[model samples]
Target: MAERSFHVARLPGFATMAVAVFVALYLPIFTLVAYSFNASNSMAVWGGFSLDWYAKAWANEQVKDATVRSLVIACFAAVISTAVATMAALGTTRRRAFKGQTFIYVMINQPLMVPEIVTAVALMILFGLVKTVTGIHGLGYLVLAHAAFCVPFAYLPIRARLEGMDLTLETAAADLYATPWATFRRVTLPLLAPGMVAGAMLAFVISLDDVVITEFVKSGGQDTLPTYMLGQLRRQLTPEINAVSTMLLAVTVVLLTTFFLLTRKKD
Candidate 1:
């Protein structure tokens, strides 16, 4: 009975801790979202509610351009990174271990192990050389940089799915004279789709929010949404920033909710 009372006494502490954690994580988000409708420019005063900030954010040419650039970069990064990482996952997990296989795996996943700033600096130096050699300046450099960062993110879950998969069915298919390409196309690919989708979404989010590499590799006039937000911060804190932040938060919420629903285990 004494021990039971002690446990009961601790329950409130645990509950309080959990609530504290949730509040700590979400209170800032809630404040940002709430401030999006603030009539006043200053965040301190409520100044009643208004949607003018949303309108202003929408009408802002710089915001529109940056948002579009971010979307394009994320889309390209997601598709290309997913494709390459899926292939790498399949090859690494499905094949028998051979000489230098470990090295290949390490090399493929080096981006995750290295610091982002280091990667950004390396890409800056490399692309500088390329630009000097070819004289072409475009968004391709940003796309490639983002893709390099996203590869390890995409590789992890796909490789796990591949490794956890049962090989007996694949062996049976082989025994029945199924071609390697056909067996993979019909069986392995279908099973691996969930992991691939999850990884791609992760890559998209990473690319969307990346400011460091984008700041480093991007040339003049190519501001992504995050970089645009940084630029705005330098000028002043306005409801416009809040409104844009709210939109980004909504997008993140939608993506995560959709991903959860899509990837949830079916009955």
Candidate 2:
């Protein structure tokens, strides 16, 4: 006789609760996206659909400048943080029976353990002092601060990838008289490329979307997109801001989806 399969029914209350949670989470996002197409400047009152705000946002010179600066900071910080994290992950994972290994790991991840506001305040104080002495003012400070903040985000994925990696291939390479550099370059690197790419993307998104650290660390006129958006919201309310927000939302969703797909479990 064939085995019988039983289907389980989902509870009505559970389904209703799940729908309520989704609505609470996504209703605002849907509203924001809808208003991005609003013809009128008012956020609350919709005056039919139009693409005028998007065109205006594109034409804004400050928006262009802020976006370029943001991308520049994100790119440099992502590269620096990802490189540092890859090294840190390798050091912690490849070594055995080391003293204070756990402590070292925790130290590397301190940025994540501490609140962003605290880190921003501390960085603001430190950078202010450095600026007073060095007379430096520009994107350099923002890049450094972002790199420090993004290190832990980049570290986790790389470390997980290293941990999940099979050692049989590496051991075989050693048995075949491959040098450490050769083994790493030929065997390990090829296998670990996906994780490194994922880490770099993660770092880039984190740095790009950061407002607290960027706002705190930036000098006068050095507004990234988030900071610029905040300034716009503070001074005036307009659909142009909504247009820009929509673009940022789209970019973030695409990058985060890619990150999610890359980090998903594979058999």
Candidate 3:
């Protein structure tokens, strides 16, 4: 008798289960997007399709301010987090195994493991003390909080890229009397670009979508798009909110797709 290989796909009802899971996960999202174009102001009613909500969202000055603020915070956070993450990745991966390596990893990813609410509360308290001492308040707190939160996200991809890199090129450069910095600049950096880009995009998306930390850390009048949307939700329901959500969803989808393409190995 021939030995049989097991496959999860071959398990009973696996395909059905997978389909059900995807539908459960995405059905609400699909519904939201579909209703974004509804002509009616009511969220629950299905009206004829129209672009009125999109136009309204575009004309809303509050939306514009929130959108710009969100973008600025996300851009700054992505740059700061990605740079720190790249350095961390190099430090952790380029050296031989050392004592407390696991500890370092856990520390780096502590935000990911800890509840977001916990992190938010901690940041709120810390920022509150700083504000009391300095009597200064600004968007800087949100940027810093987001950067810190996004570090683990950026680090993982860069570390994965570094681990998968070929050391042969660096060895060859060294044999040719190239300095470590020179080799890294000329060789390692180029190869690491994709991972860094992917990491940055992921960080950008996380920062852009962040609500808990932003809500906790922001001063008055510093609402980002997500927080603004939340505030609107508290006040009323409208297709304009749905339209804004759909636009954000589209942007997130694009960035994530690009990240996937950049990080995927060409086989």
Candidate 4:
């Protein structure tokens, strides 16, 4: 007979814990989402239901500028991070394990292990030196910084997909005397494309939502949406900020949904 089912006995406890956890996590989000529709500027008490704050957020020039800048930075960061991650994943997975393989993997994922504030401070100091030497300014640094930070987020899924792939097709391709480029082009690349796309989307979202690194590295007048929202918060609390957050939340949900759909197809 199977082992005695202690799990069943703990089921009610687990259920209660799960409910408590979900409420703790999502109640604040649900509250914010609800207040986004509130007509009054106050978040605590709902005056009524209205879309005025969203309209105001849409019409704000600062919001528009920050949104566009964020999109541009996210696009560049995602493309760069995804490409770098894909190459790293291939290097790590498509060959036999070598000496220092674990070290290399750890190095690639360092940003994730390192504290964000530590990373941010380090980048800030490094970029300060780079700026002194290069005299370059504006979005370039932000994009590069974002890409560096987002690389691990992109790398994880791509590496996982590559690792999960059956070697049979790849081995057959090799046996067919196909050149490396042609074999990858014909077989590995096609299979890996969805993972790459998923990684890119994840990287894009990470870049878009980043605020700490952005705050540390961004030059004057380079405020991203998150930074802008922070600035607004510092000055005054407004329901407009909630509306902006809701819009960002909407964008994030859409990207995550698309990522899930793509990964589901892969599965």
Candidate 5:
């Protein structure tokens, strides 16, 4: 009875703590989403409900250009990262643990573990040197930075799937006198498709949201959407920014929904 009463006494505190956590995490998001619809220019005071800001933001040439640039960068990064990650997963899973395996893993995931500023500083210095030597003022530097950073995000799911997959199917294909490439293409590739798609999506989202590395690696006059948003924020706060944010949120939701629908189990 004493133990039961003690447990009952703690329940309210646990409930309070959970409520606090939920409020802390979601209250700001709720506010931002709500204010997106405010008719007034001031975020602090709501004048009315209006969609004019959305129209203005959509019509902005600079916003359109930034959005297109961001999409192109994300697509390229996703493709490159997914391809390299798939190859790395196959090699790592097929081979026995080696002296360099851990090192390679660390290097691949360094972008995630290291501070953003550190990566930005290193990339800036490296690119500056490359620019001095090569004189190529291209956005390829940004593409490389995004792809390199996205690799670990693409690597993890593919590696997990490869590790968990049964090897018997590949063995049977080999026993049937199939070439190694044929075996992989017919058996392994089909099995790995879902994980590869998931990893690619992950890489794409990471590249899309990235700002720090982009700021460092991007040449002058080549700003992605996030960088453009940052610039706008620095100058002034406007409902147009909020409208842009809402559109970005909608795009993300649509992409994630599409990914889910594509990956869902079929009867």
Candidate 6:
């Protein structure tokens, strides 16, 4: 008899475990989304469906400011992290294996391995010194901190893309007397685009949703959407907060969907 393939899904308890895990993960999110539509002010009591909370969140000047600030910071962090990650990926993968390659990867992904609170505290201290020395208290510090934190998120996808890429086209380009820059711009970049986009989207989402680092690095009056929501949670529990959360969830879902489509294998 032929040997059977091992399949985790075929295990007796797999389906039950999977369903349990999913419910555990999504039940709260579903509840939150459901409450976002609640017409009543009371979080526990359902008062029929309504859009009042959404309108309230939309009209709140603080919410608008926080949303805009989050967008700005996420955009900058995505671009900065993606660019650095691309270069780093190219440097590491487009050459022969060498000493410290593993070390380089470890250093690149240090943010992912280290506790986020530790990174946040380190950034807080570093930025504090910079602030005291330079007197440059601005959003730049937050932007840089976010970009640094996002780098590993961006790097993994780009490096995977670079590794999976065929070297034949690049060799052909070189054989055809194409310069390295031209080869990269024409041949390598187009193939790498999907991964770059996916990385950027992931980085953007990470930065947008970040609270710990943003909380530690931000100056007074510099509240991003997540931080703003956190502050609101501390002060009060409202369906308006739920509405804001639902909207944020929608944004995250849309971006992740697009990222999935971009990175999916073309069959």
Q: Which candidate is the best by lDDT?
A: 3
- The reply for model 5, stretches above 4 Å from the true place, is 1-12, 256-267
Candidate 6 positional error at 166, Å: 1.2
Full-model lDDT, candidate 2: 0.92
Candidate 6 is scored at a TM of 0.96
For residue 89, model 2's alpha carbon misses the true position, in angstroms, by 0.6
Candidate 4's clash total is 0
| Candidate 2 local lDDT, residue 24 | 100
Give the residue spans of candidate 3 off by over 4 A.
Answer: 1-3
TM-score of each: 0.90, 0.94, 0.97, 0.95, 0.91, 0.96
Worst-scoring 10-residue span by lDDT in model 3: 1-10
Q: Residue 85 of candidate 3: its Cα lDDT?
A: 97
lDDT of 1 by residue, 115-194 (tens): 98998999999999999999999999999999989999888877877887899879888888989988998888998899
Instruction: Between candidates 1 and 4, name the one with more favorable TM-score.
Output: 4
The C-alpha stretches of model 1 lying farther than 4 A from their native spots are 1-12, 98-103, 262-267
Score candidate 4 by lDDT.
0.92
**What is the lDDT of every predicted structure here?**
0.89, 0.92, 0.96, 0.92, 0.87, 0.95
Candidate 3 per-residue C-alpha lDDT over 80-163 given as tens digits, one digit per residue, 9 for 90 to 100: 999999999999999899999999999999989999999999999999999999998888999999999999999999999999
lDDT over C-alpha atoms for residue 185 of model 2: 94
lDDT string for model 5 (161-180, tens) is 78878988899999999899
Question: Model 4 segments beyond 4 Å from truth?
Answer: 1-3, 8-12, 265-267
- How many steric clashes does model 5 contain? 0
What lDDT is reached at residue 180 by model 5? Answer: 96
Give the higher-lDDT candidate: 3 or 4.
3
Clashes of each: 0, 0, 0, 0, 0, 0
The candidate with the higher lDDT, 3 or 6, is 3
Q: Write the per-residue lDDT of candidate 6 for residues 111-224, one digit (tens) a residue.
A: 999999999999999999999999988899999999998999999899888898999999999899989999999999999999999999999999999999999999999999
Arrange candidates by lDDT, highest first: which order?
3, 6, 4, 2, 1, 5
